[model samples]
Target: MEIDDLTPAETRVWRAFATGTPVDFRATDDEDPSDGGAWGAERTVRAHVLRALLLDGPRAEGEVPALNLAGVRVTGVLELQYATVDHPLRLRHCHFEDVPRLYGARLREVNLSESVLPGLISHAVRVEGVLRLTRARFAGMVRLGGAEVTGSLYLESTRIQAPDTEGPVLQLNQAVLGADLWAPGLVARGEVRLDGARVAGTVNLTDAVLDRPGGTALKAETLAAESDVLLRDAEVLGRLELRGARIPGRLDLSHARLANPGGTALRASSCVIGELWLRQGPMVEGVLNLRRTQVDVLFLEPEVVPAWVQLNDLTYTSLIPHEPAERRLPMLEKGDSYLPFVYEQLTASYRRIGDDDAARSVQLAKQRRYRRTLPWYGRLWGHLQDVTVGYGFRPLRAGGWLLSLLAVGSAAYGLHHPPPLKPAESPDFNPVFYTLDLLLPVISFGQENAFAPEGGYQTLAYVLIITGWILATTVIAGLTRTVSRQ
Candidate 1:
């Protein structure tokens, strides 16, 4: 277009683009555009005019061409689909008439910080430099699926509210980021999906607020992050699904609030994480699932313990705080379903930390949980084993039981002696020897075979024999199980 064909605002923007100078329409940097009545023709730029200047613009001999305009009202859709523009685009604090479509567009540094737009579609686009949307407000969806960003993608203090839309408000699914995905203080009214996203650097969403009640707040399933995925101090009013995600660094959600009552609050099942920190008393109002999640170090403090959890097949090498089993056992009991492996894993974890007594306590708790699933007869037998030996976790209990039974039997028989069946064959009728002979099922003292008790004394002798067999059998089974575990 000729110079005479351009308007005053267009002429200034075109002239500044050649020298890479930023044109600020606002009176001051902090000037509120909404407070003004309207944007006049001098502050308005057509999207097609901006596109034309970006695609083919005259530049000074030693200057790089760029379209840096601030506080301008961009009219019409900025359609640069499948276009390759090498110039840096900085449209800070600009107001857009429609969502800019950059589908499959390759660009350099693009900063739309503090802009007010309906939406942005940059799917399959490649950005060589950073893409900043800091403090930007989007009233609709922002789709960046399958995009590649060499530098970090910053969304600091960005707010996206798509209340009428059922789809994700901010979709970054399957995107590959060479650097970090920094989105601290982001507020999304709908779902924010990062499914299958691979980030070379950290995925930080600290202080973000995601509100998609009864639906997914953040869905990052199968996401692979080289560095930590920090969601610290986030407020999620829906499900935070991170199933099958693999993070080499920590996945810290400390001090976050996850509320999806009667539904899953945070499901990280099948995840492989280096350090999974859910400490600092995060409020989880729903089921916290860690089923099949494998973490190297899990920092789960007592204050953050959820009432309902799914811990089946969850494996953690080290538990932080290293608290006693008494404190951690309540966490294992939160699951509704009986999972023996969870108990075994907890027991192993305690043992690894050289807390043998705590480990034994976990084992005892495991037996108690297992007993609830058995039939009446099986439960009866379990009670016997538990009372007498503490399921072999407390070996001293077995000795105490043995000593008590011995004293009871010796006292009962010492009051009255049974008449000897063969007076000449039997040795002196000793009450202690007679009691030992009846109590010890395998060992015989020769007194039981020689003496024949009648009436109530005979019935007491039968009770002693049966009780001896039960104690001997239970002790052997418990000892064998304990030894095998060791």
Candidate 2:
């Protein structure tokens, strides 16, 4: 690939690109056969012009001189399909007549910053260096599916407009990025697909705005990121899907606004993350679903409220600092059956750190929520047992009941002096033995039945018998529950 071998047109392109001299051609003069957009519109450079100037030799290694084609208006599908470039392509401030076709191409770097194009189809393209599309405007779909970039994929301030709501504006499934995938200030009309993508650094989408109202704005299932997935101050008009995604760092949703009324706004089910920070400035109109997500920490700040927060099967190791029980409890008040399990999860999280007091409070909170789910009569019964015996969780309270009843019966026998009808030579008022005989329903100590009651003692005897039966039933039920637990 020497300069002497170039054609007349190729030499002209090389003179402008290689020598840093400006070249202008009539874009409307020749109609390229490979036009991918704007039907019948004439283009500037032919498909082979820029390709001949930018293509690097197959064996070319290490860094070569960068091809600076800034502000150039290239024509029909700047097709560089499988050509390997050893140097970076700096096409900043350029206006493409159609989409660039870099599919399966190997490049050192590709920078199209501040450029205007119909679309970009570069799937399976391998870039050894960065790919910059900063502030670039796309009128159609931008497909970079399965592309592998050794460096970052910078799309900051980029605006993509795809009229089709069903299709994605940007597709990057399984695209591996060694550095950050910077899309801050990006505005996409269709879905932004990052499913199965792996980013070694952060997926920085901070302040990005995505608008796809009836459907998903972002689909990022099975995405694995080593650093944070920052959506700070960003806004999404539809659902943000992150199902089965793995982020070792925080998924910071601080100051983010999500709107998808009656449907799930943010679905992060089965995701494994370090922490999920829903700060006070965040707001979600629809459900914030975290079903089966395994997060080590959940840092929920005050004033962050979603229409519904579905935390079913969510497992977290701890609550972050300043996220007290009172503050976090209201977030679980979605008025659903999952409320009890959310409290249970909080209890388990606290117990994992040996915070039994916090665990107990969570248990009490769980019981309170459980009571809310019951019918009126069931609630009454639950409240009775909670005050007296803590719903069989407190077995020792049953002992308290027995002791109090025994003491009261004994005092009644000692003070009233109920006349005994036994022929034995015993004291007329044996309060201790008589009370024990009355309390133990299954075993008779020959003290209760051997004596006949007199005056109001008959009514007292009936009360003791009924109390004994009730206490026996409660003790048996508690023991059964404890044994079943084991």
Candidate 3:
């Protein structure tokens, strides 16, 4: 391992290291000097280049390093652990045919820009300082689980290819970051898992595109952020779960395309935030489950209307199986101004479930909530006062005009035909038929007791007078007085 007894190329590489100059394979325009003739011949020059960096000490600053392994064939593990670099580490146009390990490596103030890292494994990679990947592309699978970073982690315009499984393309499970995590314009062909990851600052995924199948586009849980969890204009082909995450500031999913097979659930249970905006892209296929999620000020805080109002637009085709009604109502109620919208959506959902009563109840509750805001002639206007003293009560209104017409017709018939007088011997009036007799007019064609002609005419005259008085009273009452209490 002595520098003096090494080969000429190795001596030159050592000299470049000592002199703080650039050490790149492309600089020499030949294969790495470490790849001897007796060792594996098919081994790639890039492998030797990586081996030199791993085994070597700290690299000097301002080194124009480049490792172009565009088509190099490799079959073994490429370890680059504990390597410190002050300059940018360029692996542009490189292709890893197999999985490569770079675990526990400290990439401090380095740039891996415009590189293609296929199947790169960086498990437990402690990035203490800033690591920039402006336009790097990842072809196969990549794992960044349990990685911790103290500085800003920038991945702007990065592309991550989808893996064959239903899992995420880039898994950042249980990772912790001390600074802001920026990934604007980041495109992922597969899902992204950041479950239990904690970021002290904002977790920005603005303009990021995440495309996947029926699986979730982002599966993050317990993500505690001090600032906003910004996902503005981020397109998610599958569900986006922020379940059990705590966001101190706003949770902005504005203008994001969130597509789920049935629906998407942005469950942020037990989390506190200022606002939750589902206002941008509301054409969600499923319910936006915010079960037990707590918001401080505003919920369903939409930036615009009509275009971003699809929480209740789900049809019967999107209905799922039965869930507990009590449990579901709270989730729908968590959003502030969107409570009405949520209730409306839930009503539709309940209707799809064949629970019409529940749906009606939800509608009634909404009406009651905004009853005071209604016009003076509205149905709920003065509802409470009307209930207290029986004001504005109208049973006839319920029966409509048909009952009134019937009452009028009965009165007309009674006026035309007066009831007959009972015999003088019969003193008592039959109480059962008395009301009916009063209502109908009895027409007399001939006189009774013809033997007494004077008496019959006199009785007929009295009867006519009495009938006239009764008819007049009935007409006056029917016209002047109201029939029944509502």
Candidate 4:
């Protein structure tokens, strides 16, 4: 592995490293560059081995030019396990033509800036310091399972290609990230799985476009974080599942487009956050399932009125729901009761969009579904009373008395004139006499003879008159008592 005894290609690689010059390797037909004479075609192989060894050792104290490992495709695994370089290890403008394996490699402080890694497998890799990969592109699968990164993981302006079998483009299961996981302007053409990953800081995916038509764009479970999971302005072409993810701060999904047609579940079950907002978006398909998800402040912003169709047990300032527009208004009005406030703030929302009817229907359906929830007395007696009061049977009873009064008046008027007889042919032809003879008797006994003839009707007339008088007197007495109490 000495420099002088190395081949011409190896000498070239060694010269490049010594002079701090960029090493460029030409692409060959064979997958393994070592198999052909291509090994000597690029640079010193001994220098690469030396550089790898130095990276695994302690960092040099003085400032030096960043080690550029650009475009040197390794035939076998690029083993840089336990690397602790002080100077930023630059892999700028490099291309990994084949799948590169870097298992257990410790990148203390590295910058893979603007690199193209088509296929990469860095399982159990520990990044102690910052790992900046700004403007990098991944054409194939990238796995980083069980990785522990203390510093910020930057992936700005990166593009990850889709997998062949509708799998995730980037998988980071069981990884412990300390600083912010920033992926601004990053685009993923496949699913991005971070299941069981713990982020200490914010997991920002702002302005990122994720296209996963066959599956979910982001799937993270038990993702506990202090700061907000900011997905603001991020576009997901498929489902975004955050099942069992807990955030101490807000889960901001505002101004984001999430379109998943396969009935994909956007579950955030058992999650605890300050707020979970999906507002400010024009469209969001699939259910925004939040079963058992707890939020300190649930903001339904005014501009997001039509975004949500249904909600369940989402606690807010009030247990009642509010119209997005009216939520900002004062809760109390002049001389208004709390019931009206609750009704207006909560029930009015459903009533405005006709959802109240649907909610009532759902409640009724639930009553039928879980009949045992109610006691027998409540189900039978209380429910029947509710129906009766709702239909206003008391008002119908009042109308019955009015109908009877009108019937007695009409019958008595008919009996006095007999249709064929005229006023001029009447016996006395006097109005006062007619009034005393006809009107007084009719008023007194009209209830009995109102619908019958002379003899038998007279007997019935006395009974009906007495009964009618008694009913009228009782009604008047009840009204008096009610008025006195008031």
TM-score of each: 0.94, 0.77, 0.57, 0.61
Query: On TM-score, who's better, 2 or 4?
Result: 2
Better of 3 and 4 by lDDT: 4
Off by over 4 Å in 2: 1-13, 19-48, 56-65, 301-312, 322-344, 364-384, 394-419, 422-457, 472-486
Which lDDT tens digits does candidate 2 get at residues 1-486?
576765554456565564445443334423232232342223234555667666642222342455565445566678888878776677766678778999999998788887788899999999998999998888889999999999999999999997953589899998999999999999998899999999999999999999888789999999999999999999998999999999999999988898888788999999999999887575678888998999998887657767578888888887765445676677777735645677878777777777766666666567767887789998986776665556556767878987898899888888876666766754455787798888889887667866777768788888888878777776676566446633
Error of 2 at 342 (Å): 5.3
The ten-residue window of minimal lDDT in model 1 covers: 31-40
Is candidate 3 or 4 superior in TM-score? 4
RMSD of each: 2.1, 6.5, 14.1, 11.2
> Which pairs of residues clash in candidate 1, taking residues 3 or more apart in a chain or in different chains?
none
Error (Å) of candidate 1 at residue 255 is 0.6
Per-residue CA lDDT of model 3 for 1-486, tens digit only, reads 455554554455446543445444333344332222222423233354455644563444655443323223333466666555443343433344446676877765545555556666777888757656666677776677888888777778888885665556887888888887789898989878899998888888999998875778788888888888888998888777777787878788778767765555344555556667665475555445655555653433222222222233222222233444443454443333444665666676677768865665565455444554568776443353223211212222323332333354334433432333544543333322322333334632232211121344345434533543444343433333223210
Q: Which candidate tops TM-score?
A: 1
What's model 3's lDDT at 461?
Answer: 36
Candidate rank order under TM-score: 1, 2, 4, 3
Model 4 bad stretches (over 4 Å): 5-66, 69-77, 81-87, 301-313, 317-486
Error of 1 at 353 (Å): 1.2
